[model samples]
Target: MKRILRLLYYMRRYWWQALASVFLMAAVGLLDAFRVLLVQPIFDHVLHPGSPSQIISLYKIPGTHYQFTLQQFVPHFIHNVWAVVAFTLVVSTLLKSVCDYAGTYLVNYAGFGMITDLRDDLYEAVLRRSLSFFQKHATGTLLSTLINDIERVQYAMSSVLSEFLQQFFTLIFTIGVVVHFGGKLSWALLIFVPVVIGSIRRIGRDVRQTTRRGQDRLAEIQNILHETITGNRIVKAFNMEFWELLRFRDAAKRLFKANLRSVRAQAISSPLMDSIGAIAIALLLLVGRGQIQRGAMTEGAFFGFIVALFKLYDPVRRFATFYNNFQQALGASSTIFTFMDDQDDLVEKHRAFTLKGFQKSIRIEDVGFAYRDDEGEKNVLHNINLEIRCGEVVALVGPSGAGKSTLVNLIPRFFDVTSGRILIDGHDLRDVSTRSLRDQIGKVTQETILFNDTVRNNIAYGQPDVPIQRVQDAARAALAHDFIMRLPEGYDTLIGEKGFRLSGGERQRLAIARALVKDAPILILDEATSALDTESESLVQAALSNLMAGRTVVVIAHRLSTVRRATRIAVMEQGHITAIGSHEELMQQSPIYQKLYQLQFMDVQELPEPVMMGKSGL
Candidate 1:
């Protein structure tokens, strides 16, 4: 019930439309009751051709306690019975049709409006979540929540609101008319009321539970589809198409069974309600005949009473169905609300200082870090200390899992250090706003992250309105201008997904151009050239050199030749900095550095001579 109320809270913005719809639906119910009452006059007066007293009695105001007749309200000269009945039926039917159309339109207007507002707000909340949140949740499951779950909720809200209003008013009006005519005979309906209510409650509970499980199964199917389609290349390379198909089939089968269970539960309510209603009708008829024969009821009134009683059950049955649908919507709402209420792990401080630009140097002091895992916290880096002055290129080199990438990631505060602090210029990274801190840094990774956009837009991604001439100049410096001009539409051509239309070297060059256009004071290149072929590597390496001209650069590379030109080399091993010096200095003084260098170059082939020798006599 709380979740349902929360869903209704979204309707506050559209209250006027809801109110109008309710009033119109109430009018519709009054018209329906009048239609049933007309049957009494048609049977007793128009069809029977009764005497004047009998006809006048049938025209009495429709209530047990009220005795005034329509003849008292109209002149006898204009009160021809056939003309009055014909005119009343035609006008009432026409008015009811208009009210029905207007009422349905208003309700749907409010429903669709609420859905639009909810979807926009939910999407904005998703965007505000941290990187770690996305790491934990699957893309397909989130998509299912945003698209599928919200769609289900929309159907439920619209259907339930429309039917609930119409049926509630109809039930009230019909019950009033039944009691006015049938009196004691109407009490027979009380027996079936509890039965209907109890059955609806039980069926609704089962449907809600089964529907939640079905939605979960549907999410799993979406996850599989997302994975297989996005990673189709890998699937084909490994020849696992048949395997993926079988997995999809299994997930789909589970979803089918779950939906069947939910459907079976939801479908049971109508027939059960109808059967119970039939029994109540039988009891009413048996008692109604006795009242008619005893002259306690008019034959016209008795037949009208039967019609109103049966019509009352229509709304009752609809209410039961509405309950079933409302339960399904509640299941979907639970998933959506849970995600919206989740707190982000990375929260910025209030009124945090903003960094304008880089100054002297960056200092890493007594840093330690760990990544959370299923077993427990696993340490990734410990007791790391380093100082990088402005305009110096410091190359971080080591074996896999040596924490080179993790150490550099600390500067950007991607994940905060578990122990010590890092300072840029003089301000602690944590003390400054993340947007301001990141604005001063640019990064290019081995896997180039390019959007499916034109060359002009991709190069000027961060600053979309950057001048065309500046974009071209940045591309020229990155050596991408030449190939870009050879394309069909030059800079206006659309690059396919992730720039797959371009070759490896072209894609890396475009990534470099993007960073060059941003022109931040600090840069980090993580294995940027390692994936390309020989020729592509030379082109990309030259572009990297130009990009690193005067920035404080942190280059993490496994290739020995790539880092040879750095101002200094820092050798890391097992989460600690083992040595830091010039490449030649480290080669002679540090055995760990020497072992790595020898393994890569194999006896210093195509390299400079040794500048010094250590006690180890390398």
Candidate 2:
């Protein structure tokens, strides 16, 4: 019930449409009941053509001598029984059909509208989540919740919701008819109502539980499929085609079993309700016959009562099916709500001001950071302190797992420090709006993330309307223009996913071009040239020199030539900055730096002299 109420909250914006649909469906239900009442007039007056025309009593007020006549409903001109019956049937049927059509359309409009907004908000919510959220949740599981779960909810809101409303209203009016004619005998049929409802509720509960399991199993299949597709190169290299297929098959089988469980639960409810309905009908027949024999009920009235009772069961049976479907939708909604309900932990401070520009120096005051995993929090950086002023080229050089990348990431506010604070131009990063803070920063990483887009579009990525001249200039600065012009479409060439169509060095050059176009005040180069060949690394370094000119640069360098160009080199050991000085100063002052330089030359005595030249010795 709580889940259902939460689902209805999404419909608040479209309540007018929902309300109008309800009124129309109510009219449809009333007309349906009126059709059953018309049966008696047809048998008692219209079918007996020689009988005199008289007013027909539509309903008798239960406790008084008052009754409602057909004359009160139809025009005065329709006095004859045949005309009245024909008019009522034709007009009522037409009205019922019209109401059903309009009601269905309106309800669907509201349902679809609500779901569309819901899907948009869900997508926005997922996008707004912090980087840590993505780490905790699998890509495939999030995709399933975004798409498949929402689809199930949409089906329930549109088709199932419309049908349920119609059935509910019809059941109400049909019961009214049954009570008017069946009178005391109606209680026998009504007695089974509790049993049918109980059966539906029990079956629906089982269906919901099984459906949730099925959704989880489906997410597993999606995860396996996503992994296989994204990591196809790894799978192929390891000759794991057969292994992957087996894994997929196992997940598929689990999903199949879950679906079968839900199907079995839903399928049994229909027959159970049918049996209960049959028992009620049998009892009604016996009692109804006695009433007719004693002249307490007319033959036409008894037949109409039985017809109305059958009609009542129609909605009741559909109610069971609808309930099961709604429960299935509820199961899916539970997963969606879990994602939507999560508060974004990385929310900006209220009234946070934007960083207008970068000036002075960035101060990392006794910063500490920890990454949380299943084993709890593990410290990544400890008591780290550094300062980089404008136009200063500071490089962080350390062995692997020394927190170089983690520390660099904190500059852009990707993750907040566990203790202390980072100040940009005397303004705390936390007090500044993240968007504006990041906008002033540019980054180039070793991975070189490029989209499946034209060279020009990729270069001018975020600013789609950037002038072509700026794109060409940035490409030239990054030394990517010559290679880009060689492509079949030049700047218009469609680079395949992650720029697969390009060589590793060419892709890296393009990433540099993108950063050059960004032209932010602060630059972070994270192993920017680590993966390139010597020739490519030289060209990228030349490009990095242009990108680094006059900008406050923080680079995580692996190459000796790059480290030598820095204003100061910070040597990290474990999670602490053990030394900060020029290369000569570090060699004289720090043992770790001395040993690291010695190790690089240790194996280089036998190699060709050219290999040792411009090498990253530490």
Candidate 3:
């Protein structure tokens, strides 16, 4: 009920439409009741006017508490009895049709409008969540909630609102007619009301529980589909197609079983209610027959009462079905609300200042970090300090899991340090807005991330409206202009997913071109040339050199040859910087550095002169 109320709150903006729908639906109900009431007059007057007294009595409104005849209300000009009945029936039917159509339209308009707002807000909320939030939740589960779960809520809103409102009013009006005509017979039927209510409540509870489990199983199927499709390449490479198929089959089977349970629960409501209604109707018939024969009730009135009683039960049955559907919708809404209510722990402070630009250096003081998992918090980095000066190329070299990439990640505040603070130009990084802080830093990782877009768009990704001439200049600087021009469509060619159409070197060059376009003061290159072939590596290395010129650069490289030209080098081991000095100084003084240099540069004659003889390469 709370979830339903929350959904209605979204409809506040469309209150006028909702009110119009309700008004029209109420009119529809009133017309339905009037049509049933016409049964008495049709039998008493038109079909068999057994006596003059019967004719006079037929003129009376059948179901009204007061015995006011239609003759009293009709104008004298409208005199023919058959013409009056014909005209009234035809007009009532036509008016009911119009009101039903208009009512349905208005309700659907408001319901769909509410769904549109919900989907948009859900998307925005997901986008605003912190990176860690995405890490914690599965993409497939989130996708299911955003699309499938919300779709269920949409179905409930449209079907439930229209049917519930219309049927509720119809039930009320018909019950009034039945009570007025049948009196004692209607009161006898009330004895079974509590029984019907109890049955509906129990069935609805079972349906809600089953539906929730069904939805969860459906989400698992969706997750499996998402994983298999996205990881198709990995599956093919490892020849695990049959294994993936088996996994999908398992998920589908589970979902089928879950849905079957919900289906059984939903199917039980109709027949169960019908049987209960049958017993009540049989009792009503048995009692009403005696009243009709004993002169307590007229034959026409007894027949009309039966019609009204049946009409009343129709809405009751529909409401029972609606209750089950509402429970299903509530189950879906709970998952969606859970996601919406989650707060990002790393939200920026309201008044944080924007960092304008980089000036002197980036100082990492006493920084420690840990990643939280199911087991416990595992510390990755201990107290570490390093200073990177402007216009200097400093390379970070270490073995795998040596915290080289983690240290560079800290500069951009991707994950805040668990302990100490980092400062940029004497200002604490925490005091600055993330956007402003990241605006001055450019990164090019080994994996070359590119969107499935045109070559021109990919190059000018960050600054989408950048001039063509500027984009061409950046491409030329990164040595990507020639290959781009040689392509069939030149700059406008659509790159396939992740720029898969391009070679490793071409893709890396485009990444460099994107960084060049950003033209930030600080740059971080994480193994940028590590994955390319010899010729590709040379082209990519040259592009990297052009991108690094006069910028405050942090390079994390496993290839010692690549970092040989750095103004200084920091050697990290475990979670600490073991040494920081010129490449030669570290080679002579630090055994770790010497071991790495000797392993990679074993042939001294092939070593770059600057590294062998301690000369400045930059």
- Assess each prediction's global lDDT (C-alpha) against the native: 0.85, 0.89, 0.85
**Candidate 2 lDDT:** 0.89
Better of 1 and 3 by TM-score: 3
Best by TM-score: 2
Positional deviation of residue 447's Cα in model 1 after best superposition, in angstroms: 2.0
Q: Sort the candidates on lDDT, descending order.
A: 2, 1, 3
The CA lDDT at 242 in model 3 is: 98
Candidate 3 C-alpha RMSD relative to the actual structure = 5.9
lDDT per residue (tens digit) for residues 182-293 in model 2:
8888877657767887898999999999999999999999999899998999999999999999999999999999999999999998888888888888888998888899
User: Model 2 segments beyond 4 Å from truth?
Assistant: 50-54, 62-66, 71-80, 486-490, 528-530, 533-535, 594-618
Best by lDDT: 2
Off by over 4 Å in 3: 49-78, 528-530, 597-618
The model with the greater lDDT, 1 or 3, is 1
lDDT of 2 at 503: 89
lDDT of 1 by residue, 365-445 (tens): 999988776788889998999999999999998877899988987887777888988999888888889999999999988
Cα miss at 337, model 2 (Å)?
1.8
Worst 10 residues of 1 by lDDT: 53-62
